[model samples]
Target: MTDVSRKGSLSFLNPFKTRSGSRSSSRASSVVDFKIGDDARKSSISTATIKETNSSGRTSRAGSAKNSLEYTRSSRQGSTLATTGEDGWDRDAQTGERKDHTDLLHSLVDESTAESLADKAQAMFIGIPAKPAADLFSRFPEGVWRRIVEFLGPADKASLAFSCKPFRTLLGTRSWTDLNSPQNRDAKFDFLGRLDEQLPNHLLCFQCGIYHVRTQKGQEVLRPTNVSNPIFNCPNVFNLENKVARHRITVGRALPFPFVQLILRGQKYSPEHGIPIDSMSRRYKDRDGEWTHQTRYVVVNGHLLMRVISSAFATPALPPAGLRRLLYSPSDNFNPYFSVCAHWRDGNLMPAVKCALSHIPKPPEGSGIAGTSAKVQYHFHRPHPIITLCSECRPMRRCPECPTEYLIEMRVQEDRSDPDPRKLFKHAVVVTRWSDLGDGSSPKSLEWAACNGEAEYDSFTALGKRAISGTFESQFTVDQIPGQKMVSMNPNKIKLGEKGHDWY
Candidate 1:
C-alpha cells in the first residue's frame, strides 16, 4: 500500500519538480559562466537550443517532448564528461572558438561591402578632379538649375556664378535672360505707371480762361469760361461788353474723359476810394469837395479781367449808423476776377497784389455813417504795373510812359498848440512815373520821390509826375534810394525823450 501511495505522490510532483529544477539550474549555470568569463559561448549555445525548442514545440507537443528528453540525457552525459577540476580551462577553450567563428562571419560579409564602397568613392573623387569651389548648377540639369537659381537669394546667386567657370556658364545664362525678360520690363513699366499716377494735373492756356489737363500728352481738356454762349466762337477772347453785363462767365468742354470745370472769381474792392467793398460803389468824394467815381476795366486775352473803382467817401455831416449800414451792405460787396488760360505757366496769382488787398476791410471800410467827415483814406493804394509786389508778382508789367518807385514814409498829424498829439501815421507807397522818367528797367536809373503835404498832386499819377520833373531834386543819385542802406540799431541809442521818440 505504501509503494502504491509513493507512486501516486511521485506522479503528481515529479513533472513539476523536474521542470523547475532544470530552469533554476540553467540560470545558475549562466551566472557561473559569466563570473568565469565564459558566458558568451555558453549563452549563445543555450539561447539557440531554447529558441529551437520553442519553435519546434509550436509544431507538435510530442516532438518537443522527445527533444526535451534527448536534451536532458545529453546534458547529463556532457556534465559528467566535463572534468570538475578542468571546468575553467574548457570554458576558456569554448569561448575562443565562438569568437573565431563570429569574426569569420563578419569578414565574409561586412569587410567586402566596406571595401567596395571605399573603392567606388575613391574612383569617383579621382575621376572628378577638384576645381575651384563651384556651384551645384553644372551637376544639375537645366530645369533643376532654374529651380536652384530661383531658390537662391540675390547675393548667393551672384557669388555662386562668379566663383568658377563651369558654374558661371550654367548660372550666367539664366541670370542674363531673367534680367532682359519681358516680365522684368513690365515690372519697370508698372513702377513708372505708379509714379505718373501720383503727379498732379497741369494747367493749360487757350484763348479763354485757364484749363486743367493731365500731364500726359493728348490728355482730357476742360475749359472754364462763360456758359451763356453755348457755342464758343472765339473761346479764348475776353469780351468786355458781355463781361461787364454778366460779370465773368466760364465755358467747359468734356474731352475723352469727362471732367468737371471749376471757375474761381477774383477778389474785388470799391472803386471810389480804392477800398474793397461787398458791392460796387457808384459815388465817391474827392479832395475838392466833389462826389464822383469812375469804373475802369482791364482786358487780357480778349476777356474782361479786372474792374477797379472806389467806395463812396462819407462826409462829417452824415449819421454814423447810416454810413455803417451803407458800407456794410451786401450790395457793396465785390471780389476780383482771376482768369487762367495756360497750364504749366509760372506766377498764376500775384502775391503782392493779394497781400495789398488782404488789408482791406471786408464789406465796410469804416464804422461811421455816410456823409461823416471822419477822415478816412483808402485801405489800399491803386495797383501799379511797374512795382514788383511779392513772389507771386513775377514778370511785372510796367507802363513805358510812367515808371514806378516805392517809398516808406511816416507823418504825424497834430492840431496846432496840442502838446501831446498822438495822430501819427506810417505808410509805404509804390510811386509811379514822375514826369516821364525813362523806363524803370534798371535799379541804377530809378529815383526816389517825396510824398509830403507840400507835394503838388495827392494822386499817385501827380506824385509820379512831380518825381520825374525833379521838383525836389537832391544831390543824391538813384543809388541813394532809402532802405538800401543797412544800419545796426543799438538798444542803448534808444531815447525816451519826446523829440528822440520820433527817431524810431
Candidate 2:
C-alpha cells in the first residue's frame, strides 16, 4: 500500500510501519511509547506527538516537540484514537489537508469515564488535589486578621465589610466599643498609631478622637518637644486629651494624664476674632401680639480699625453684609451692643475678664422686681481663659411687652502692679438689643440707648423671665501658658466699658 493508504490502517502495534514492506525512518534513536489502558478492545491515541527530523536523521533540537503526550485514559465502553499522517503532518481527515498544530492535547473519553478523567486532568494541570473550597480568612488567627484590617483606610474597610457575608460578619459584628476593648489592647495602639500617622496635629484632638477645622491660622502655638512625654502639656490639647483618655479607659486603654506641664513661651497667639450676629423676632402677647424683630452685633477690633479703611478691597476682606447694611440703612441706626475680649503676650495669661453691664433682665433695680435673677462665670488657663455665660430669668419687667434684661460683668487688672487702673475697659460688647449699635458709640467702648445703672451698667441683653433661665457658665479653659512664671502683681480692675480706656 502507498504511504497514504498505509496511514489509514496503522495501529498501536506498528504506527510507523509502511505498506511497502519497509520501516519508516525514525527521527530519534530513543523511541518513547505510550499506552492508554489494558483493555483488549479497540484503543485510540488522543494526541498526535510530532517532532521535526533533520536531514541526517539525528536527534531533534532540545525543545522541538510540537505535541506532548497526555496521560492515557480509558473506560469499559470504548476509546477514540489519534495519530499523525504519513506526510508527517496533523490533518483533518474529512478535509484531507494539514491542520494547524496549535490545538491542545486533550482526550475524548467514553461516557462512563468523562467526569473522572476531567477532574484528574484539572488536578494535574493545577498541580493540586481536588477538595472543597475553604475560607481563607478564617484560616488565620484573629490578631493577624486585625492587623490586616488596620492597614486599610476607613473607606476601604467599609467596602471590604460590604463585599461578603464572612467579611461583614467579622467586621460588622464588632461594635466600636468592642473594637476598642481592653481585650484588644494591641488593636487600640495600632489604631492610635495609624491616627497619628494620618491626622495632622491641628486637625486631630488626640484626647477625644474628635476632628476640628483649622479655621484660624496659627492656632497651634505649642507642642510638647519631649517625644517621651505621655500627656499633652497644653490645656486645649489636654482638655481634649483628657476627654479621650477617659473614653478610651472606659472602653479600652487609659491614657496617662496630668502628664507633665511643659509650657513653651513666646509662641504666636491665635484669637477667634470676628463678627457675631444674634437676631430674633417675637410677638408680644400683652400688646395685641405685634411681631418685632431685634438684631444685635459683636464687632471685632480687626473689622473696626483695619479693613474698613483699606483702599485695597476683596469681597472676603470687606465687612459682613449684615454689618454694612445695618450701618448704612435708613431709619435703622448704628448702636454699640456688647464687647468681650481676651489678651495674651509672650504666652502669659495677662489679666483676662468678661463684663456684664447692660441688657440685664432686671426691672431698673426697683421698678417692681420679679422673682428672677442671672449670673455668669469665666474659666482660664494660660493664653486665654475660656468663658461661658448662661443666664435665666422669670419675667422681671413691669409690663409684659418689656423683656427682662440681663448683664455680664467681668473686670481684669492691667500692669498687675497698678494699685488702681482708671476704671475698667471692655474689648467687646457685654450686652445691647440694638443691631444698629455700630455708630455713635466710640469704637473704644460699648454704649447703649439707655442705662439702668449709669455707673455700673456697661451693656444689655433682653430675655423673657418666664422662658429660659439657668446659670450656664461658659465651658472655657485656657489651652496654653507661658513656660516661665511671672510675678502677678497688685493688678487693679481694668476699667471696662469706659470711654477713654483701650482694651484691644
Candidate 3:
C-alpha cells in the first residue's frame, strides 16, 4: 500500500505494512518507510526514467541515471523526437539549458559500429571490481568461452587472454603459446604492437620480428640509405638479404620505418614512446642533381600523411634528350629524380613532366628563360617572373594503385648563383607528392604495402573524393589552391612498369 505524505515531504510504499498498523503478507516492495517516532528508516535505490523514442514512433520510459523527468500531456506528433539544440544536446523543457549529461557515445559513434561495441566492452572492464568481475567470469563455462574465441584471430585471442587474470585463467596459455610459433610471427607482432604504451624503451623491428632496445632513443636522426644508421642493433642489420622497412624519397634520400613508427607512436601514445612528428620533416638538396626536396608529415585519423615538394630549375624549350637527362636516373632503372611512388612508371607521370617542361616560357627578347642577350644580361628586361603551366600539368595526379597523389607545376624563382642580373630569375619544375602512409601498425598494412608496390589498393575507391594533397596543404597555409582538379595518375589502369616505353 502506498502511503502519501504532504507535498515536498517524503512518501513510502511498504507492502509488508498494513493500513490498520498490523503485520501483513511478507512480500517485498521498493522504497522507504517510517513509523511514528520509532526511527524506522529503510534504504532503497532511486532510479530516474528517460523516454526512448523507438523505430515504431512510440515513446517508452526506461530506467536511467539520477535525474528524473515526467512527461505531461505529451503526444507523438511528428517524429516522436524533439529537435536538438545548436550544441547538439537536448535542452531542459522549461530552463532552456542543455542536457549535456546524456548518452554521449551516440554523438561519437553509431550504435551499430564495432567502435561502439569496443566502448561497451571497455565499460564492462571498468565497471566491475576485480573480485566481482572474476566471480562473474566464473559463471561462464570455459568450453563456451573457447567456442566463442574460436572465431577470434591470434592477436585478438592473445589480447583477450592478456586483459585480466580471470581471462588468462579461463583462456589458458594456448594463445600465448601459439604466438611463439614461426607461422604466427605476424600475429605476434600485432599483439606486441598493442603493448607499445608500456614499452617506451624498445622499438618493434619488422625484419627481425621482435622488439629491440632503442639505442638511439630520442636522439635518433634520419640519414642516407647507404649510411650505417641503426636506431637499434639487430642481428639482421648485417644480413644483406634482410633489409629494414624504408621508403625512397629522392634519388639519394630514404625514410626509415622506425622514424615513421616513432612519429606515429608519439602521436598514438605519449612523447616518451617516440618523438614529435615535426622532427621527421626534412629539406635537402640532391648532391648529384639540381632537385631540392622538402618533406612534411601530418597525422589524420591515425594515418600518416606525407608531403614532399621536389623542385628543380629548368631551362626553357629543352630537347627530348635534355629532358630525359634532367628527369630520369640511370642508376635507379630510369626512375624520376623527384619523389614518386612505386607505380610512377606505369602512368602518364613522365609524359606529364615532359609536358610541364615544354610549358616553361622562353624569354621573348632573350636567348632562353635562364639566359639573355650579352648586352641585356647585365640588368633588367628579363622574362616575366610567372611560369604559367598548361592544363595538362596544372592539376593534381592521384595514383590509381596506391594512396599517393602528385601535383606538378612550374614556378619562377630567383637563381641566386646566376652570373647575369637580367636572367637571375628562372623557371623551376615543382613536383609535390602527397601520400597516405597508413597507420604505423605494420609493413603489411594496406597503404604501406601498396606504397612499396607489394600489395594492390585502389586509391580512388579507398580515399573517395577527398584529396590527400588538400589535407596536407591545409595544415601549413590558408592560401589553398582553388578549383584544383584531381585526375588519376594512371587513367587507363595500366600495370607495365619498366616494360613500358611511354615512361621515356
lDDT of each: 0.31, 0.28, 0.77
Candidate 1 regions with alpha-carbon error over 4 angstroms: 1-147, 150-166, 186-504
TM-score (all chains, Cα) for each model: 0.15, 0.15, 0.72
lDDT of 3 by residue, 1-504 (tens): 234445215323533332222122111111221211233433211121011112222222332111122122243332345553266766665557766655666755664554666787887889655565577677888788778888999999999999888878877899899998999998999899998889999999988777899998888888887689989989998787988888888897888788889989888888989988878889898787788889889999899998899999999788988998899888776778999999998889888899988976564444565455543654466456676777887877899999998888888888898899977878899898988988989988999889999998999998999888777776776356434699989899987876898788
Per-residue lDDT of 1-504 in model 2, one digit per residue for the tens? 599777666654664332232123332221333333344412332122233233234435432242122222332122432343357776654455676544433332344356767787776769555443236666888688778998875445555565666667667845334544557444433344333323333333344433344443233222222233322333465354344221001011111211100000111122221111221111111111111122212233211110000001011122344333322222212211121111111111111211122222222222222322211111122223223333421111111111112222222222333356642321222221211111222111222111211122222233222211121111121122111111211123233332422222
- Candidate number that wins on TM-score, 2 or 3: 3
| Cα lDDT tens digits for candidate 1, 1-504 | 999998877785632221332444333333222333454566665564465445444324454456566667987888877754343432223234222356679888886676667788787788675665444544667787677678875435555565677667767755434433455543322232222222234322222222334333223222323233222234433555433111111112111111111111111211221112222212233332212233222222221212222223222233444433322322212111111111101121222333432332222344566423332333244323222333332222222212222221111222333355442221222211112221111111221111111112222443333332122122223333232211111113232322332211
Residue 162: error of model 2 in Å? 10
What's the lDDT of the predicted structure labeled candidate 3?
Answer: 0.77
User: What's the TM for model 2?
Assistant: 0.15
Decreasing lDDT order of the candidates: 3, 1, 2
Model 2: which ten-residue window has the lowest total lDDT?
Answer: 305-314
lDDT of 1 at 372: 34
Best by lDDT: 3
- Which candidate order results from sorting by TM-score in descending order? 3, 2, 1
Decide which is better by lDDT, 2 or 3.
3
